[model samples]
Target: MRGITLALDAMGGDFGPDVIVPAALQALRYYPQLELLLVGKPAAITNYLVKYNSISNDRISIVPTKYIINSEAKPSQAILSSQGTSMRVALELIKVGRAHACVSAGNTGALMGLAKLVLTPIAGIHRPALMVILPHQNNGKTVVLDIGANIKCNAMMLVQFAIIGEVIAKQIIGVVNVPRVALLNIGAENTKGFGNIHQAAKILSNISSINYIGYLEANELLTGKTDIIVCEGFVGNVTLKTMEGVIRFFLSLIKSSDDSVQHNFSMNTNIVCNFSYMNPDKYNGAYLVGLCGTVIKSHGAANQQAFTTAITQAVKAVERQISKKIASRLAECWITTE
Candidate 1:
């Protein structure tokens, strides 16, 4: 297979070029065959590139852009204002086929909006969704989709997210034969939620794309039972933040409890106690799904490690052909057949 070229918007994250530069270098070390298109101020990148003592080589290229969409700016307004923002330029590279995939740590809404406007969703899909993989305590990971993209969704959309999520889980985590899925709800009962989730549960139960296991209580997520959690944007975002908060709390408690707790704790408790060992590939990153190219939204406060993992994830997305495979799988179900 030919090496994949990834276009990275290097200007927008909180840590800026300091994070993006090394992450790109680290990714290059891990995947020597990959080509990089770094979008940012040339002088800044050149200074860092030379500090690392590697001349601007053939494999590394810079596409300098003058404007950046700050994290404080409204996603819609920023998208409308600048055509040459680093993120937009990266998407253009993908549209014109200069790169196999695109990535940015900028405004999530604008990134998705611009991507949808430019790349276009797969033929049967109505709107693109945001999918994220969370490190689960079950010796594996769980895929959560529509985490703050398209707040209002129908039963059909959730079902489509399930199919898209399953394809991604298979590629990234190597799971096969359909991982178990659950609807995120206040409780496990079918009558426990409102119209969107309640109706979506019934459809999921009959759908064969995912091994639908009924509704999942927020408390039951890390039990190692469900592999995918399907829900609307607001609910998914809240659930994710709650999980992060709880984990951090417990992790602090464990560290403060005793000096020998490493040996005193059980497997499950130990997993929850260690934050350093379980640092998520990124602090907070979202991959824009259902588009022609792979793109990611990195947390504004992302550090060098987050950038490293984001780039690493993009490489996997490229190798796995996440966008193309998601579209093909959604077609098999005849989604959006009028």
Candidate 2:
């Protein structure tokens, strides 16, 4: 594999360098051809590097920045004051071709704003969408989009998400057949959702390139019945978080059970193992797709392993030239509501 370099926001997440530095080192060990630019306060980052005994590692370099974006800052506030922040610097690296991709566990609003300002969206795309590959019951995966990028979307925007999700399912997830596309709604009936949802469904149904399977409820999300599930940011974000919470709650039940109960559960090891796959840690990275460059958003509260998973996600996107592929695919089958 060719060498790929990624820029990381060392001061972005809840634990900052405490989790990022170790994750960086772990990624470096896993991907021999990977190089990293750690953008943050030098002293803080170097402290972790020294503790990890990788201060002299050749594949890693530090790009100093003084400011840090607060997690609660608004997107407009962040953009206006983003000049010297670690997240902004990391994204700028991608804009200037200093790195192939960027990964940040920072404020989602700020990251989305800065990435669009720095890299620009693909031609014909109004806005980029946050996308993630979710595991399903069939041991397969589903492509979900607009997790938190846009709070509300119109018919056109939802249709665009369907097209983008389809391309992702085919290009990134390697879906063999025409990927099944569906709108996430309150019910499976045609008249079940809002007008925008109905309009988007009508549009998708007409697009020959998309295999629109109509509406899918929240309960069917992990059934592996559909390949792509499209919805506006607010709905998608809430659904993703809800699923994570439920999985954690179930896992907690098993772990906190009595000795006798634990023994009974242990007898059904396969059931416990299956629940492990539902852990949110395994799906920590969400791609800010539709940009000219690759940007991955890790969960702000992610641990070392979860952040490392985000880094590896960036690496895979860089290696696959995901942005370029999506752009080409969109140009070939561009659809408009006009």
Candidate 3:
């Protein structure tokens, strides 16, 4: 297999270079064919590389930048002032074909805005969706999309999300059979959601190519009944955060339990191991799909391991030629968001 290069926004996350440098080093060790373009202040990146004794590594290179986007900057504001920032520079690397993919732990809105501007969307895609894979009850994985990309979506956009989700389930998640896709709704009944959602559902049901299951309520998200869940960004974002909060709460309860109870919990290796699956770190990378190139959004507060996971996710997407696969799948559909 030919080696691939990834552009890293080393100054974008909460801990910036302090966290990113180590993650880059770790990923290099894990993948012998991997190369990194660390985009940030040279001094800052060098300090950490020296600390890790990887400053002189042949595979690592630093691309210096003069500015960093503010974590709280709005998308519009960030776009206007984006030049010279590490995040924008890293993305530009992909635009110029210097890197195969880009990964950043930065302000979500800015990253989304910069990426759309620099990398451009796929030919037929109106908007790119933020996608993540979540663990399901049956020990399988579920692909959820539009997590935080577009806060408001119309019937056509929701339908488009289903199409994108379906392709993702098959190509990325490796779903063998026809992937069952569903709309996230307030109720499982046909008439229980907003007009656009109902319209989207009706449209999905008519498509012969999609395995469109009717509706899925929020409570049944982990039931493993569906392969892909599609929703507007506002609802999907809230749902993801709520699930994360609940997982953290459940883990805390186990930690604060009585000694005997904790001892019993620990002894049940299966239960303990299952609970560990809920760790948010393992699911840190959110793929920004529907774009022409691969861009992964790492959690802003992610630790070293989580950031490394994000880098690996980018590698896999590039290796799989995910964007091309999505484009090919979309061409087969008759639906249009225009």
- Candidate of highest lDDT: 2
Clashing pairs in 3: none
lDDT of 1 by residue, 223-338 (tens): 66778888898888787778766766766766666455556656546555455434544435677788878887777677777887778778888889888898887776565331
| Candidate 3: tens digits of C-alpha lDDT, residues 1-338 | 14999999999889999999999999999999999999999999999999999878999999999999988888799889999999999999999989999999999999999999999999988799998988888888899988999998888888778888887788777899999999999898877989999999888888888899889998888999999999999989999999999898877766666344656664555655787786788878999998999999999999999999999989989988989988887877774322
TM-score of each: 0.90, 0.95, 0.95
Q: What's the lDDT for candidate 2?
A: 0.91
Ranking by TM-score: 2, 3, 1
Cα lDDT of model 2 by residue, 44-162, tens digit: 99999999999999999999999999988988998999999999999999888899999999999999999999999998888899999999999889999889999999988888788
Structural RMSD, model 1: 3.3
Worst ten in a row by lDDT for model 2: 329-338
Q: Determine which window of 10 residues in candidate 3 has minimal summed lDDT.
A: 258-267
RMSD of each: 3.3, 1.9, 2.2
User: What is candidate 1's CA lDDT for residue 330?
Assistant: 77
Inter-residue clash pairs, candidate 1: none
